[model samples]
Target: MTSTVLTGISELWTLDPALDDPARPGDVADAQVLRYAAVVIEEGRIAWTGPAADAPAADAREDLGGRAVLPGWVDSHSHLVFDGDRAAEFEARMAGRSYSAGGIAVTTDATRAAADARLRDLVRDRIAEAVAGGTTCLETKTGYGLTVADELRAAQLLDALIAEGALDEATFLGAHLVPREFDGEDGRPGAAQYVDLVAGEMLAAVAEHVRWIDVFCEDGAFDPEQSAQVLRAGAAAGLGLRVHGHQLGRSGGVALAAALGAASVDHVNHLAAEDVEALAATAARPTAPGDRPGLLAVDAGPTVATVLPACDLSTRAPLAPARELLDAGAAVAIASNCNPGTSYTSAMSFCVTTAVLQMHLSLGEAVRAATRGGALALRRGDVGHLGVGARADLHVLDAPAAIHLAYRPGMPMTHRVWRHGQEQPLAPVPPTPTP
Candidate 1:
């Protein structure tokens, strides 16, 4: 394949893994920044990155007009396979009603009712929207389809997209909530039976299509013990563990995740000081490499505290304690948590801006959380940084510096994007309905 040399970059935030110092702990510092830089891309990998003056000759050369560049955003939590909008529920929440996990059933009905082709179209559109905004690597879950058949369909759809390189990670979240039918009233089986299905038959059917499994460990959903049951089942099936934890209260998701060696625990809106310490403690554990293809190392890595800023804002919930997590030596990631009931936009830039302006993270910290932090949460090392041999995923910005992401908040700053060495069309997608 022919190589391309990209020049005229005013600032390049390489975030090269090679520059990460073990002594600094969770700091992704400005030491990795390079000025007057250029990059060489060959065979969809970064062949070289350094001063523009020392750039070697290549098959093609393009100037970026002094714009800034960074690794494409890696969003590690989202729900894009579903087929409906929850604008009505959102409006209710904004009009003084509180958010609840019950809203998940509304989405489940619509997603289950959608035709296979329609659901595929909807998910593809959402992925395109995310890419247009510079999200190159994203992980989506299959929680909207509560039934065995519906969940299997969603998983298969995401698996196909992964095969085609249109998506990155797929997770099985069959324990999202107990569907209305399983409420256990008037002869219906209760949450216990539902949990059994998730840990047994449902998991058996979709386990081949997904790499990770997640449970909503909160009130009105699976309790701590039930969540543990499901996570253990997935682990037995050779899947990495993830958790939808502590979003609405002081749930036991953090303790459970750390104990089970889960890769990530998202929506941490209600963490306690002890919960922070538990996650930080996991950072010192040595990671074991995955023995199978298409799966993460299930037995290792820190339980990343994935803060969903957009979801917190839309639900009127307290922002996650991202600052404290980082300060305490715990790993942290920023994600959109894009879903129908709460967060509906796949804009990682907006999430990063919120992390900086509201969550008290510095620009570098926020960007790193949204990119490298996310990659670590998913246990994938190749896409988060622009190090040598990393995927050629570049997010070229309209501004000269990355700080403009927050300084010029809400402005359209994505000048261009390239994923895996090929340019992506930034066609405007319809504005995702907000809560």
Candidate 2:
């Protein structure tokens, strides 16, 4: 059997709760042991994990040299595809101009004009950069390509990446905005028609490549009623629903997402009290019999409330209601929301820091949101925790504990990374001098 061992961990944040009874609730919110630990990997899955001294023997071993070990980060929301920059729009916004969802159209135009080669290259480079910084699993959305052809091409590129083992998750976001061509006399297409076109044609063309269907449900983008239609159609097409909600204003994005039972409602910068109540209500409910939810069933699974701190940092908008969500007992997740107009950085560490400092989440809560919460948001259980039977994906931090990820925000603290039982070289080491 293929096997490898990782030893000398200074601390391990398994992100799995230490439960009194393993057969009971998983206790996903409470972290498990923080003891010094080592992990064993076999056939790309975790075989054993325990105290360093008790680590199981493997065919080969690599000492981590007392580095902090934690599950590889899972970034559940991001718009990583597209071309061109929005620096000018950002500069203008900082110079007293208000932010508008209209900037998405500008990027849509540029993305439509860009060649497939350039878009693929940019996405590949960005994914590599994120992986080097400790992200083992990430979700990318295609929003800038608002047209059918462009959106399909974007999904094709994502499929190519996945086939080549470059990235993991891909989402189709044709409802990101109404392209200039569709901007009829009123600057938007007929709501029913738009949803039909996207759900029937564009979505069908990329259905095999995309797992989630996303829409920017804001005032200047698609309205609540329009977004609901899109969500319903996407549900019919067997794609999970995610939303870009309430970033610029209180657009009922949260309520809409909850009503439709979306996998996650992202960018909750304008959540209302009712929205908080809805999230908390779902959190208190028991999980459905099967771990996977039935497709198109309105009440199949709990809706995850995801906060995009990097988006707030770029748009200068109020932070997502993270504190209120947690206080109300809602299951919350944090993501980079990496895009051009707002939140262009892929640093989950920075996102965690913003959640703690600006959104008032405790260090532990922020870490949980970035790890287990992300997995919940993506409706997956095997990637964000270092439990046995999970994927052998982990991050080795330069610091001694997971809290340092937020404590030292802007520094490059990710020293090494491991994926599928193989340790990746962080940097080339020089040859040893002759004895």
- Candidate 2: where is the Cα deviation over 4 Å? 17-31, 186-192, 285-299, 425-435
Candidate 1: where is the Cα deviation over 4 Å? 291-296, 430-435
> Could you tell me how far off, in angstroms, the CA of residue 291 lies in candidate 1 after the best superposition?
4.3
Compute the lDDT of residue 330 as modeled in candidate 1.
90
For model 1, the local distance difference test gives 0.92
- Kindly list the per-residue Cα lDDT of model 2 for residues 69-112, writing each as its tens digit: 87887899988897888899999988978888888888887788
Each model's RMSD to truth, in Å? Answer: 1.9, 5.4
C-alpha lDDT score of every prediction, in listed order: 0.92, 0.79
Against the true structure, candidate 2 reaches a TM-score of 0.91
Q: What is the lDDT of candidate 2?
A: 0.79
Candidate 1 local lDDT, 317-433, one digit each (tens): 999999999999999999999999889999999999999999999998898899888988998878888999888999999999999999999999899999989999999877434
Give per-model TM-scores. 0.97, 0.91
Model 1 backbone overlap count: 0
